[model samples]
Target: MLKGITENAVQSLIASENPSDIQFDIVVIESNKKQEEYAYPCTRTLFPRKKFGFHKYFNLGISKTDSQYICLANNDLVFHKSWASEMLRAFDADPSLVSASPACSIHHPAHGVDLYSGIHEGFEVRKEVAGWCLFFKREMLDITGKLDEGFTFWYSDNDYINTIQKHGLKHALVSSSIVDHLESQTLKSKDEKEQFKLTHNDRFYYEYKWGKRSLFSYLNIKRKLFFR
Candidate 1:
């Protein structure tokens, strides 16, 4: 977490209206070994992990705790006071819900979802929630297993939903809970040229595992890559 991004995010949760009985824990899977510390609420553990891959860190983080409810959140999110309470209420109301994501109006436009725009009150069932923040029951891990570590960075979310749905699990977008996504903060730190290369690498791997998105989707990348 560059700057005080992770600290700010954690403190925001401490300032929020959390569930009374729920013991909020934080497991920091650091992208680099900066060894920064924060005065966060509840139990906290910091794991210095310089390696990349979304699932690799997430799976490791989850293993660090035994909380019934697990949330995989990005470092750049500023959570609203109502976010935690509202998200838990949704899970309590629907036992069938395996995973849910909070709505974030402050997310970057490139994130592809204008959270508050065209969104309605309460929960909206869907095949997938936004990748920035994912909240789910720990039992979900038992069913879907660890997300495919094969996904280097991108497409882990896509693969997660595919496995989730195949197991008859459902996910929802919790509009009542809101947060801010300083979208792709880590990716933004990298040069644009490198970003494209990494994204294409993930895309190629995704297609290799799941087949082409569609016949035409293959043409979206370089023709040389497509033929190769």
Candidate 2:
């Protein structure tokens, strides 16, 4: 399912609006040797068998690009042709908007249909943008540094949001941009024991790095500030 989604996503981008105007590259990151054929169509495909951490792969990809703007996308997303252009327009609209994301219709764990409606109705301001389909200037990376490698997986996006906000940078949800996300499609399929160990370790590492009393403490604050 994940491989099929990746292929479809690549096809969608190839078929998206104004393909000639949007000069971009697609980088696919995977762990299995058998997946090389699946990722071969991309501009560049990486296969790192070891558990080098999520942020490491992100940084590796970013390091390979010289584009002014960078978008970190997940494999489970189905992007429209206008997606890149819409996100670019948001950055163009406000110089201070350092990072942005499209309002997803089917964000998992919590459906984002309402959030999408609100954003589409012109209420796009957001405290922390999800990493699922995130866009940002390269300068933000220069300022805040690469996504904290310590995060490995969980809370990395939150860490990014907090870091940039502390530096007076801003983020938003680009209402016009759109993507259909099959969220947690891969992670949900993982063995429960492995998933639990990774989740627990990452949560503790995140709390330690951010000085949180507990995982719920961070969630409690985010719920009030953003969900409200």
Candidate 3:
């Protein structure tokens, strides 16, 4: 599943109007023994096989890259020609921006709400940049250390944004940089109950880490009060 989507993502890069302006390295973090092949133009590295988790692998990828800029994209995304340049412009325009991502339908619901609702011409500074397609300078890694391994999979993005903001940095969505995201395509084949459990646990962990009540707990109490 990821193999195909990753291939499409690479194709999108090659199809870009200014393909030559974009250079990238592919880092594949395999969770299984099956080795996927890439015919893309960039150097490729496959981390040792491990259980599926975003933060660990993302950190591993970051460690491997020596570029001044780093852009992380989920395998299930297709980039637009302007995606890289627009995000670059945003970073250049705002020295305070620690990270930036393209506006996409399949982004964090709150961050991309305007784009998903048909208003997509302007940028937005967001509380969190979705993990699916994130762009940032290497300097941010110095400040945040790394994505919290405590959030091995979920809420890592939230934790990442929070960490950056704590250091007086911000992230944004460059509206002109659009991408096609097939959300959760990476987990489509996973058991629903297991997925729910991870999400449920991660939500609570995130809330606790940030010193807030979990949304589920708050909603449950609200429901009980309403019924009473």
> Against the true structure, what is each candidate's TM-score?
0.78, 0.81, 0.77
What 10-residue stretch in candidate 3 is worst by lDDT? 116-125
Q: Give the per-residue lDDT digits (tens) of candidate 2, residues 18-69.
A: 7578877878777555654544474587787656567778888898889898
RMSD of each: 5.1, 6.9, 6.6
Q: Where is model 3 more than 4 Å wrong at Cα?
A: 17-19, 34-43, 105-128, 213-228
Best by TM-score: 2
Question: Which residue pairs collide, candidate 3?
Answer: none
Task: List ranges where model 2 is wrong by over 4 Å.
Answer: 33-38, 108-128, 213-228
What C-alpha lDDT, on a 0 to 100 scale, does residue 218 get in candidate 3? 55
Backbone collision count in every prediction?
0, 1, 0
lDDT of 1 by residue, 77-106 (tens): 888877877888888887777788888765
- Cα lDDT tens digits for candidate 3, 84-200: 777777777777776777777455454536552321222322323556777889988888787786675577677777787788776766666778678787677678866765566
Give all candidates' CA lDDT scores: 0.71, 0.69, 0.68
